[model samples]
Target: MSAARVPGYAELLTAADAPVLQVRGDWTLAHYRPLAEQVEGLRTRLGAGIRIDTEGLGALDTAGARLLHSLLGGERLAALAADAGALSGERRALLRAVAAAMETAVAEPAPPAGSAIGDVLEHVGIAMLTFRQHVVALAGFIGITLESGLRMLLQPRRWRPTALAANLERTALDAVPIVALLTFLVGAVVAFLGATVLANFGASIFTVDLVAYSFLREFGVLLTAIIVAGRTASAFTAQIGSMRANEEIDAIRVLGLDPIDLLVLPRVLALLLALPMLTFVAMVSGIVGGMLVCAVKLDISPVMFLSVVQNNVGLSHFLVGIAKAPIFAFLIAVIGCLEGFRVSGSAQSVGEHTTSAVVQSIFIVIVVDAVAALFCMEMEW
Candidate 1:
């Protein structure tokens, strides 16, 4: 058998004005370690004016070619290509390919830096654009829902009473105990705080007015809306998103059915009917709790508490609160259904859209409440 050839080595020759690096022997991976170390040592000492002579190279491979190309750098390799005698046609082609690849691997330019105020302004602009897009989408969804609702009203046979009833039971009846319990506790806490503050001024009796005004005008509908937004809205998104992910919505469309009417109308109608009733229940529960607290802590009788609430709290306040409930319910249902339609065909998409639905429902409910509050204030309601 023939003896195995020795690994490659690089020799720096400094005899001429420009230094010359000569490569020789087998340059394959099996003999590449010593060649790599020798090339690396010569890399720093070599200058742009250095000449690489690869004519003596034997058994060259991709690894060796890469090592040599990197040692010479792209500019130097390009310059060396003109002198074709120094490398074989195959080695020359390999070197050219490596240089071209290295050139393409150049990093992208760094982003420009800006002042702190400029960065803040840029972020604000982006946020405003995103908000505008969200608002536009919501408005489009509302228009579609309204169109469906009008069509349903014109054709009463299209109504899904069973689905509406089921959703109503899920969103309202099952939710009653928690809504009442939460509002009741909040009412008691408000009464306690009001009594503590008013006692310093010797007007603890005003605590009944405080609790009644707050619950009847704000807390009742607002708390119920928030609860429904978190619970029913998320449920709507998850259910519809799962259906969308499974292509059931597409199947409905294929069967000549409108997904908006079949899927969204039931939820919207249910919430419209349910929210007002739940808000009324919340108002009553909260008032009862406040009455209990006043009776126990402020030495006020239940009859006197009811008399004060009846005399001081206007019917308009209850009307204002109840009026906001349907609007909030509409928005929550629309947002949930809209997000569900946005879902992609994946389990992850369902989860992400469900979360988005709850967040958007809550946010829009708050915005609507704020706007209504401002309108009521201006009108002196």
Candidate 2:
């Protein structure tokens, strides 16, 4: 067992018709907790001609003096300070000071607590503000790019055809395998789902129509655009972010050449040119995959599938899908190049901006695609 603690205290005693309270132990801030607890009930004991004995007390501090003042009123404390041998000179001065200051101290009112609804509203407001900021930034960037593009149009010598070609190859031809493969797999999955569902209605042959319509109008361009957004957008951001990190963008500026023209324009133009072609390839690949599934599972031959697609699906659906390509392409390239320019010197910043580019591109593409789908439905095209 541990030894008992030496806590600060006050003990009362009665002698000669007078109550005596003896205060003892180290009454500094460190020991104030126990000291305060011990003296909690001592207030009721104070009566006429009460004697407070402080000579037995251990080390005393300002906190101790304040406790002493609280036990006895300021008058009694002042009286204690004035008395002979009651306290040391320094302690007496401290007690007198505490009594004087505590007399003038005013407590401020407490602040109101926050509520759940207020906190939720605050977060929503902040999100809306951030969204507005992003919209404004995107619009400004678009304007700057458009202005630069117009300048290049007026002056054809400034066009970086070589850079555009290189970016096109990277963003288009290099990406064909993944884009084609993913759409092909998705097409097969769609076909499987359609066949299983349509078979229940004794209309399994309509699976060909379903697959053709989906791939030609919606899935083809939408899937290709989404894939390119995730693939090409991130690449563009990383490339330009690297240049920014290495200060090559600065060097280009120092060399008196426009970074927008030399870097941004080429990537933007490349994506603008590449996405449509990729969309075409994706459409073909998806249809072929779906056709293969139809041939194997539904016993539908390639010739019949082609005939059904040609006779049933109009040229309008294909046109509707292809028309969205340039818009998706432009948005993805701008988002990517914009995020790349946003990158600071750090590798972490490059990575963060690259991720932002991909997310923004994909989000924008999906939203626009949805809106286009709605518009097309309303127009009956």
Candidate 3:
């Protein structure tokens, strides 16, 4: 640019007793700094029905068109550019292009302001929505499982006894040792705690009653269910989730096979058959543990422990704990299998769904157990 070139300027002037902006200069990149300053002050006159006169406007590059575009704004700039008498075609196109760029370009918006209460409410709302969606999915899975189970029951020839037996051995037989060991240790701990507490009241012998009542009513089935949920539920999910990830489930569908029969029923039937038996094993093992503790601490014999349990704890307490097993088993199996089917055909999705299955199974088991406890207490059972 020549040193004698006029710097861009927007001057407010009066014409016909109304304010007008007069844009003049070579608004090239070299003139941008001064032009920017000029437009900054003159921007306030915009939208006041102020007319802009670019009739004598000269030597505008994009930089200059930008300055004029801002001063005139989009509508006024377009009108000025549109007027055949106002500018040459090249200048008009430059102004139009600059105006289009200025108008179409947008800066990203800022995030909404947050307050303590608003953040808390937002989190609570999200949690509630997530929980609702989970419930809906669980209910749908349950419906599908029930329908499939009912259909299988109607078709006796379709029974897969081999699958049922294999699953039972895996779930029930394989789990027995761990279940017995854990319950036995827990029972001994419970007895020891009971003896320590009751001894202060000179009622240490009631430790048998304490162990029996707790084991028969809650700990037996609850522990067994939790163990199964953690162990077998994860297995179920990983097995089926891998199937989904490998497209094996898809292949099964293509082959007109019902995966519910080949996969779900076997696991579901196994757990249902296995859990109650494990509950029984848990109860027996736990009572044996309490018996050993009683014999050691209170000098009460195993016979006395048995006698106290038989006399004081009714059959109903055992029934109460055992009755919840099938429900827990069904929920655990269905949740594990449902999460498996939810896999998004990826290894990562399989891993995620597997973990989800375990968490959901454990959570549902605990919730059901708590609700049953409340109901049984209210019923005086």
Q: Per-prediction RMSD in angstroms? A: 3.1, 5.2, 5.5
For each candidate, what TM-score against the reference? 0.88, 0.74, 0.75
Best TM-score among the predictions, by candidate number: 1
lDDT of 2: 0.88
Model 3: how far residue 332 lies from native, Å: 0.8
lDDT, model 3: 0.89
- Full candidate order by TM-score, most accurate first: 1, 3, 2
Q: Which segments of candidate 1 are over 4 A away from where they belong?
A: 1-18, 24-41, 47-63, 74-88, 100-107
**TM-score: model 3 vs. ground truth:** 0.75
Candidate 3 least-lDDT 10 residues: 1-10
Report model 1's TM-score to 2 decimal places. 0.88
Model 1, 290-309: lDDT tens per residue? Answer: 99999999999999999998
lDDT of 3 at 162: 96
Lowest lDDT block of 10, candidate 1: 1-10
Q: For each candidate in the order shown, give its overall lDDT on alpha carbons.
A: 0.88, 0.88, 0.89
Stretches of candidate 3 off by over 4 Å are 1-103
**Highest lDDT against the true fold, candidate:** 3
| Clash count per candidate | 0, 0, 0
Quote the lDDT for 365 in model 1: 86
